[model samples]
Target: MKQPLRLHTPRLILRDFQREDSEAVLAYQSKPAYLEHYERPAPTREEARAFVDMLCRWAEEQPRAKYQLAITLDGGQVMGTCGVRKAAPGDTVAEYGCELDPACWKHGYALEASRHLLTWSFETLGVRKLFALTRPQNLSAIRLAEALGFHRVEDGRYELTCP
Candidate 1:
């Protein structure tokens, strides 16, 4: 995608990550619940800053292969992050992922944001196939992916193909 990219849902706005989002990203990522499904360590302040910077840099690339955006609630509050990323530029296949704050869980924000992300991927990004890898224990993510029409093609991996 390109700069100023934004996707809207009934209750959320998936917009490009700004430099000011670093603090909110850091705040949620520092919580234990954020890393419950993943084995990676919690992000330090510097790591969070670097991540935001990377997202911003990716937005500016000439042939961008990634679209990781901050999930905000109706133009306010950074609730989480969502992305649809091609494995390589010009590839028709891509993978998607989303991370919502623990507090935002159960509100269906992830599902809403993810559906919008996939639509943009298929229609705007020309992605013909999309997949997601979620930890088995993360049932919420599994359900969200399924709701978006992805089926389990292998252990911990789900996929959907555009019609």
Candidate 2:
């Protein structure tokens, strides 16, 4: 969908990541234990730049199945990242995920961005099914998935079916 890929919620904007955002991404991804559930975090400027490059490449792909929108406040201060992307090789289904700055957690940004991502995936991208995988210990992700109507398909796996 070559439409500039901007999604707006009541208080957030999901937009493409830019080169200059590497600094913010690095900071957020390195905020101590904010990334405990995920991998080691984007430990360095180089890693952050790599992530931005990945996002740019995905944004440039035709059919644009991957979306790594920077979750930002209404005024454009990025606070997180969330979107759907190809789940795996040979898998037509997409995977939904999000990571919010701990400082901004519990303000419902994850929930808002996730709902918008799911809606855009189904309504615009014609995605029929989506899945979210999180560690069983990641209570927030599990709760968000369930609150957004994603069903527990198995341990640590949630699936959302779109009509």
The model with the greatest lDDT is 1
Instruction: For candidate 2, write residues 47-144 as lDDT tens digits.
Output: 88998889987887775668889998984667889988885433458888889888899999899998888898888777778888989988888999
Provide TM-scores for the models: 0.94, 0.90
Predicted candidate 1 versus true structure: per-residue lDDT over 1-163, tens digit per residue: 4448888899899998888898899889878888888788888889999999999987877788999989999899798999988867799998889998998999889888988888878899999998899999998889888889999999899999997
lDDT of each: 0.89, 0.84
Clashes of each: 0, 0
Pairs that collide, model 1: none
- Model 2 residue 63 CA deviation (Å) reads 2.8
**Reference-based lDDT, residue 124, model 1:** 90
